[model samples]
Target: MGMEIPDPISIESVGTWSDEVDVVVIGAGMAGVSAALEARASGASVLVLDSGGRLTCTSAMAGGHFYLGGGTEVQQATGWDDSPEAMADYLGLMSPECDPAKISAYAEDGVEHFRWLESLGFEFNRSFYPEKAVVQPGVEGLSFTGNEKCLDVAEVVKPTPRGHKVPVPGDTGGAGLVVGLALDKLDALGVEVRWETGATAMVVDGDQVVGVTWKNYDHTGAIRARSVIVAAGGFVLNRAMLEEHAPDLLAVESNGMALGNTHDDGLGIRMGQSVGGVADYLDKVFVTGPFYPPGEALRGIVVNKLGKRFVNEDSYHSRTSAFVFEQPDREGYLILDSATMVQPSYRFQPLVDGWDTIEEMEQGLGIPAGALAETMAAYDEAAARGEDPEFHKAPEYLVPLDQGPWGAYDLTPGKCFYAGFSCGGLRVTVDGQLLRADGSVVRGVYAAGACASNIAVDGKGYASGIQLGEASYFGRRAGRRATAEVAQR
Candidate 1:
């Protein structure tokens, strides 16, 4: 089964009302914390329910890069010239189905949101790196986390540094954000936080969700509320959901690990769906990492089992990993010579199957006749001339692979070290309202973060920090909206 939704019980069956609040937030990750904080600030009584006893989920394990820009204070402080238009255009071009209004607002109001994060003591060192890597190694807080520098990516919108690397003295990125918000915002603000329990079902009054079914003390009493925010995360942790939704991930054996803890089950998404909420991109996931490094790896070549290059090897690691899964026999080889392979990226091993010549390495790897040679010959000719006519890797990385002693490293999934999480979940509008297939809203209910399917989609489209960035940002929006809706009623 994908996700089982519990049947709603009678609101009057519990004998007496255990408690009441203006808003009840499910899960205690970044999204739930943001919601509880915003709703309380809006003068509504907020109750946060967490499956885990503490605020330690996938968000706490993140690398801490929040993709924030569009003339943000850090961007301005670092002397980067960027605007909402560029950000919006880039995002719009990449995420074709994203609501235009939401995209526009996300770009336009990004700075205010950045300040909101900063106000929470989420510190960032203001410096920019124009390199091609998954996460910047040093503590410097900014980099081009997207495909902005790629030829095709550059054509849509001018590239700008947007990765907001949160500076942690010695903390993990997601943990820092979750801890700062939990301690300063949620705990200090006195939002009612309940742990070891979470919402099992939605108590509906006709069209609107009026309460949640959860254990109050020992009894499964329903907690009445004017609104509920489902931030319980994606279904990545559920093996059944993976088989039904994204079996491609499961087929890879022990290769990729899901993002969050077991509490990341899609219980919240099912709760929304039981009430007519809709979801999209359920088949999509973020397959990433084992990014071949040494920076000059871009100068080398990647060929499938057929020994032919499929994608621009210089793109993001997610993109590289994404295409590798599609190759015949699910095999690919990274051809590198002695000079280019000097500093082997410890990310993956076997050090590219060393040989004295390209042909010898090609034969040893069992590549198709003449395919690897032709591929290498073209790449060599291009690099010697300071250009890649086929893939368009930058000239700066266009060094010749002529010094002999060539080899091939396997890029097959399950064989390479990889880690990721699900990106698809319940579909929501910019305001965080869960939407039905007919475009009607699931009133008094909202979702954000990994559960919302707003920002991160496939690995190819992801920029580091986007999941955390949009989760916290939209969680605030959802909170204010849910409270304001109750006030109007």
Candidate 2:
């Protein structure tokens, strides 16, 4: 087993401080950097300590999408009139367990947040990619990266594109660009960033958090600060934490495949918990079996071990993936025919095998001989009539798979590349103030990014860009709020 979760150290024991800052932020990813920048901009001396070198964060490896809405310039340029209320309606449905205040704040402040990011040198094209895709193949500025366009979600609110991609070529790079630009801004502002330094414990004085203890190699020290913002990333890389919180994700081989980096080992979260920071949703996780990019593959149907359709293939990949995990033994297969089966553009879902007939495919899949045939016949009949009453797949993708050479794509967690990360962490208020189990705020400490459970709580309701978007936006909130406290002091 790993080392036991540490308790917060009382400040009375640590008599000397090697350094002092008005605000100290842990982690240098989007959240941490945003917090540092906001605090410094608010005229508070700021310091950032990261366990890893620059650009080594999971944010750097992302596709660079930001889940922005509420009349962003890009949305206006693309002829879509999105409102904060509409965006909130969609997001609230996506993460129903999230604090409504946080959801409302994100939605209401989204467009301004977009402008804030742009002010930091982030860029978005004035174009849009109108497709059901994991990410825009190239930078098209905006796209539908969530379930907003799905039949059920659209019924709740007018469907509008909200996923704003940075104006960089390729699927990835937006994250790196955003992180790089934030770091550049931090450099220009003279905020000190200590890399390869980890926060070992939260130093407390009485009931309020006062600072953090740190360690670098053999050196051990602490920083005295009026306030601290814990923007440390999630705990996906920590196996023990995973087994304890989100054991279902442990089934997937995520040591190398997960979206998170090595620093996401739960220490930051544990640090918050050590200080009586309330953490909830520790079971929520985001797992994906990215089966699209060819887009046509979504035209196929996903079945379980009993050869029965389980989810609407048209839903977002993570949404569908959550359903896939609920199947017996977590067995899931994407059934397609010659006309719909194509090489996956993203290439995570692997093609199992092809058979000349549905009967042959069933035998290969090891299900009851007639199970797949009946399901295919029913699906073909509905497709021919341009109707999907069972799962409500959009009519555009409702093409019959009557062509010969039927096949399956293995979506079983271990069989296919299912990547996942933890969604739960310390609980915080809308303004980024850490909360206790009884909902009282923890003074002198704030949290943002993955360390704090903002929005984006459930995998079934998750969108593509919510993690980065919420991290940066809430990071700013936490930083600004923490610095405002310094002024009050």
Candidate 3:
């Protein structure tokens, strides 16, 4: 008699054979959700799983800005002229080492992805500018084609105001909106969702990936699939992974809360590695510096080990802040005052997670007793005389740090609580195919979002929500491609 195929596995098959599907998505963040929705839309059965108790991950905690050009409906109505070439040029300038071809593909198809999202009940504010427009200031330059002034037709890009923010209040609005919309769509499309399900490994049959072995809060099991999409996010929270992947960023306190839930620990990347998937962008990880504790906010200046300011603080906002962790001494401090911290003039808050009193904060951050006073006196003296004696910070951005019992946080050049460390990840083609170590495509596997290598376009983390945009774009592309492949087979 022929070998038995075994009865169809049930959903409760923990540590045993489980039911199968057309596709198994390893994350539920923007990329995973997008992949599931697209795969289902393309008529393939999909099972999207996440280790987080909740459905959303750091993606829900993002600023929610999607980069697009070619005069979106809102841009066109507002008379803002933007094109694919212009957007690509801006990305090239931001990341000169990036593959122009991939960046160009992102720019060219980003509009369509935005429109696709709109079709899925996702609403955009259409702010009439790019989110990280500051990457491309007022200047006419050549396009990726080396044609001088070819992108002159595009409008000026600002650091802010290029992308739309989620109308919902608070930081999570964007992530909530996108993930909510995608989840609703997936539900309507009948896609299966298994939350609190941690993927432990990929089950490969020869050269083909057959499925994934996952451990849920209840038990462990496996879900077979024709293809797998690894959207499990980057390794910002895995201290060991951070040390291994980016040792320079181990000291900074990561803005993990800023990204929402902290389950984005590169589980998918690790699992992919187990199944012969080669991880890329390990050396291209980004680093961030520490923000001034309560009283500095965006007005504070970050000084290096020698007590000197190093970068255009205003320009490098969130992305390059990781670099502070790479300092030789990995020690630096932010100089600011109580007035600035209390009021706040920029996007970042002076006191992260709220500690009210300097004493309380000092207790947690371990600042020397008198150091706060000395730093304050120095900053106050400079601010009172219309100068930054220590760091030469711009007068407008300078706020005196002379309030009672000033606060200081002993910060190293490691990942900050407000910033993550994984910047570059697995490299992928514009079409979302995971690449091999030799820069070739890995069949039956794809990557999207921060988990994939992104330094090609966003070398410095230009804005808050651009990465999510790329995630959504590539996630959808991967979903569609996987669906097509399954259908053909």
Best by TM-score: 2
Tens digit of per-residue lDDT, candidate 2, span 1-489: 243578888989998998999999999999999999999989999999998999888889888889999999999999999899999999988888888999999999999999999999857999989977888888799999988877767777898888888877777877999999999999999998899999998889999999999998899999999999998898888888887789878978842266788888888788888778878898988988788877888889999989999888889989998999889999999888988877777677778999999888999999898998899899999999998888888888899989989989888887788888899989999878988898898899999898889898968998888999999999999999999999998
Give the better candidate number (1 or 3) by TM-score. 1
After superposing candidate 2, which stretches have Cα over 4 Å from the reference? 1-3, 254-256
Given candidate 1, what's the lDDT at residue 99?
A: 72
TM-score (C-alpha) between model 1 and the true structure: 0.95
Ordering by lDDT: 2, 1, 3
Give per-residue lDDT, candidate 3, residue 10: 32
Count of backbone collisions in candidate 1: 3
**Which residue pairs show backbone clashes in model 2?**
none
Model 2: residue 462 alpha-carbon error in angstroms? 1.1
Sort by TM-score, top down from the best? 2, 1, 3
- Higher-ranked by lDDT: 1 or 2: 2
* Model 3 segments more than 4 A misplaced: 1-17, 126-161, 253-262, 283-309, 326-328, 331-418, 455-461
Q: Which candidate is the best by lDDT?
A: 2
Score every model by TM-score.
0.95, 0.97, 0.72
**For model 3, how does the per-residue alpha-carbon lDDT over 95-138 read when each residue is reduced to its tens digit?**
67667777787788866876887787856654332222222222
For each candidate in the order shown, give its overall lDDT on alpha carbons.
Answer: 0.78, 0.88, 0.60
Error of 2 at 16 (Å): 1.1
What's the lDDT for residue 157 in model 3?
Answer: 38
